[model samples]
Target: MNIFDRSKHIYLSPDFEEIIKDTIRFFNGTPVHSISIAERFHGTGVYAIYSIAKTGIYSKFHLVNRTAFHIPIYIGKAVPKGWRQARQGLSENTRSYELNNRIREHSRSINLGEGLDIGDFFCRFMILEGKEGDLIGTVEAALIRKYQPIWNTLIDGFGNHDPGKGRYEQAKSDWDVCHPGRSWADKCQGVPANQEVLLQSIENFMAGLNSEEDA
Candidate 1:
């Protein structure tokens, strides 16, 4: 069954986290299709990344292929940087336009890496119209906490930016350790986790999820 279909059970409690789950559930109803990085997305919102089972180490995830889109591997939020400031009449800026840029950055990183194909990834996003503070952040945190995507947890740095000079001396991120393609990451001095460890981590995470579902 489609995961979206499974999400029809509405939460009776009015917790803020339920809003995040509900938003994701709404997008899960959209048709699953791959999008080009060149495509532009606007507004403040949350997004989810999907992958085919045949793609790179994601094959190990063994995401059940019952839906048009595979299981969500990552979830994120984007908020217009100046939305709050604009309200205070401090600045006129409205759109951060960083949402698509962030996704494209991920695509570029994936394309440059060995054994990973940017083409295997697809995404679904929903725009949240109103917010000044960390509303998007709350939703993002909720989704990540519920899903526990490996990119968000075990292999961090999917949201990383260039640390600039002097900082390159810092150890590489677990993301770089596993995927290894970002040019800046190469300069960072760090020992990456071996493939065996990486795979084991993924396996354990999946097993835990399965155990929870069974219980």
Candidate 2:
């Protein structure tokens, strides 16, 4: 079974139903990236992330090519909370850091590695204003299920942060194996499968997808 199949819900309000349809429509539109839209994005939202490569760097992964662009690689949600949350009585401008910050962090990750280019990434997103966490999660989960993102499904840990203090004993994530150089990830134990093994697994998964589509 798919890892996310257990999360099932039957009821949906008309507003939320409309939001879901809107999110899907947004994904079908042209993708945008943080570099070009930096000033435009400043709010809590769910984003559909995509990646492309002009060279051999990402050629091993299972990605669909659209002219120069490649497949959607990940889906993420960013809410204002914890350290990044807007304090009470803050202005409207102050409440919009969550989504932009998360996207910047991802851009940093792509640029940190010499083999990858930040210019290759783009996203389709919706700014979720006055939306609760459950609704935001519902949209993100729906997109992940629809795309079956490579980073979200086979190679994990694209969303991980530094495990502070005494939490470095666990094995490193599959994502780190495939794309390294996140400084905090250096202290963790390595996954059993190396980059080549993970690549093979992606190949097998893509083959399964083709089989299902053909059948």
Candidate 3:
């Protein structure tokens, strides 16, 4: 007879794993919509932004999403205000429109980009209200892991908000460097990253994605 102690290892129960898988499937099954239309809805949950632009730097993403949105440029979540403070009950009535506002905000950011267009970006979102809202972060993280979106993994800071008054001394984000047009980002006292280096990083990331597909 062989004896093994299950307590020695940490793992999610099969049921929990299945729940995650189901959530991912639910998210993927959601309708793909334009970022321009995001302001028409309200809720809190996870979303994926896809780019089908033919920009030279983003040609790989364009190619992948041209026929089908198999790649996401970014994945993110919007959670109810105060949910993090264990005051979820209060959040229920707040009607903050977190998800809608977040997606709209992304549209504004893209509109401000030097060479980006809102029409070239599309999104798929799942609005997990009430108890399901708790899964927002988990679903976003899982999708990001599965897709390795460039905005989430490589070119960071696409989700950043204004640093407010005293935080102007912070360095500009890589996203700001690559797509600079946000007025507030200009006030950041630190120098932006080198464009060439950021482009190289993007190329390397695309190469890895290609290698994975070939495998």
Candidate 4:
């Protein structure tokens, strides 16, 4: 059964999220609990909300959470069926997480020496010393263009996520499946109109940054 068909709804997109790969592993630095939660629990019950299962037979069943990370990462949620179909709809050139170890590997940037913050999580996280955004954005826009129609159908079907109130109850089939690849947008599907949504996602993520400025 589709996981979203149940009472669970992800507060944040788990389809594609940037996490300190080390956070989920015994990287000889991070904590065991953090890695355990990331692996066993699937993700921090916090920002990058996800659905998890203990075993294969009863898989679809997952617990919803929001505060599951000590690192800041962005979650990419494509149209609804995005996770359902996997990379089958993408181009043959479409990157596959299953093909390489990097796809499922861990990442680390800043050590959350303190704990976790929601607004902090929303803030923009760039890489390659700022160049990461350019490379990432370009790729995202391309995919959005190729999958325009299907993308529209999925986002529309997933429905709207309230700015902060919690579950967007209206989504059709929410799941915490891993993203097919990093930067799924690869430039917002190449649609000029779609850029706005991508921007909104950025805006939503940087909510904490906004508050800091206000302070």
Candidate 5:
């Protein structure tokens, strides 16, 4: 199973749901399957957490408190600093050590409940662009944080790995309908999407969420 499958009761605010749907629909030909959103959190207007996942590729995305959708947006060419350092030819063991310590420190700073559970996939394989397109590279898990130098160029906004397709690009407009600027996901950036389409968006996310319940 993928990381999204491992999570329970993920939530997504209504606008986030639209971005997730648009990203998936755009990338379906690439054949990505994601985790579903589970429970609704206490937020005004529309907000939720979702168990989104897509697995068996170079990249895997699992998230908690992540407003943006993962996997699809992250896979292509998004290397954090430590991995880049390794590519320049650092020892693998050294790379892993630095990464883990960084994450532990960050995780420690936050309460157990609040942290970037971006997932083992991110921790392990750094996101990269392969011959086919964006795929995960088998880097160690801990190196993704990149310290203050901040290596990743991939967007932290809405979707992680959409390949910049027009269909996916349309999500930019849609996302704006609900959350405006500064409401970004962790390390997040999302194109605009139409929040007015709330009903249909919720239905799509619910399909994933309900599937989790069935499983």
Candidate 6:
């Protein structure tokens, strides 16, 4: 019997791994800017949002990212519109400024949050184009896997949009419960998450990060 089974496994070449590493390095080297400033740029790519808010449950998060933004509270990607439908080709409107628009939307969300201040948020983004644009989702997945950001992993719905008419049957997102100001989220008829439980989750997550660093 053959010891190695090549038929059942997929191989990942070292070069392929290097490409992902290089892409991550490029993204990390991009300048960090305030969310307002970041929303002015035009391109489709991935971004990381860091919080420096010292409010109640977020103070620990602020301390970790205050000096250098090594930790991101949220990581997300913005792809060109219709890219999903086209799958293989670029959209006809390549200059749609999807990345900028997405960041602008986030700014609006933060502004609406009762406890979140727009001034405490910052972001870093890489505007990938041409062949590199195809790697946008890949890069975003890699970052989220590496950091396991609070918004991306633990607490969800930071990236959600209002489900239009008659679609409010689902439970309200943990994020909506904690932040509590997006008008449409109020209409969600299902059970809402306990804010205390979400805060405890955030506390535990921060503790785990501390343990990892101490190790």
Give lDDT per model, in order.
0.66, 0.68, 0.85, 0.25, 0.28, 0.84
Predicted candidate 5 versus true structure: per-residue lDDT over 1-61, tens digit per residue = 5566634677746875464444334432232222221222211110112223343211122
lDDT of 2 by residue, 146-173 (tens): 7788889888988888888699887778
Ranking by lDDT: 3, 6, 2, 1, 5, 4
Error of 6 at 124 (Å): 0.4
Candidate 4 on 1-215: residue-level lDDT in tens? 65554446536755434332222232213322232123322111111211122332112122111223222222222221133443233454544232111112222211221122212222111121122222333333332343232213222312122223333333222111112122222222221234345435433433322121233
Candidate 4 local accuracy as lDDT?
Answer: 0.25
Supply every candidate's count of residue pairs whose N, Cα or C atoms clash at under 3 angstroms. Answer: 0, 0, 0, 25, 44, 0
Candidate with top lDDT is 3
Looking at model 6, residue 34 earns an lDDT score of 90
lDDT of 1 by residue, 5-122 (tens): 6457865656865666676687667555463555576666777777665654566344443335545777777667655565532234545555676677667777876667777777
Clashing pairs in 1: none
Candidate 3 lDDT trough over 10 residues, lowest sum: 206-215
Each candidate structure's TM-score, on Cα atoms with residue i matched to residue i, is 0.74, 0.74, 0.89, 0.19, 0.25, 0.88
Instruction: Flag the better candidate by lDDT, 1 or 5.
Output: 1
Flag the better candidate by TM-score, 1 or 6. 6
Query: Which lDDT value does model 5 have at 172?
Result: 39
Screening candidate 3 with a backbone cut-off below 3 angstroms (N, C-alpha, C), the clashing residue pairs are: none
Q: Which runs in model 2 stand beyond 4 Å of their true positions?
A: 1-19, 34-37, 60-63, 68-70, 82-93, 132-134, 190-192, 205-215
- Give the per-residue lDDT digits (tens) of candidate 3, residues 36-138: 8824776889999998887756766766777667788999999887778867644445566788989999999999987687889999999998678778888
Q: What number of backbone clashes does candidate 6 have, counting pairs of residues 3 or more apart or in separate chains?
A: 0
Off by over 4 Å in 1: 1-18, 31-35, 60-63, 82-94, 132-134, 190-196, 203-215
Using lDDT as the yardstick, the better of models 3 and 5 is 3
Q: Estimate candidate 6's RMSD in Å.
A: 3.2
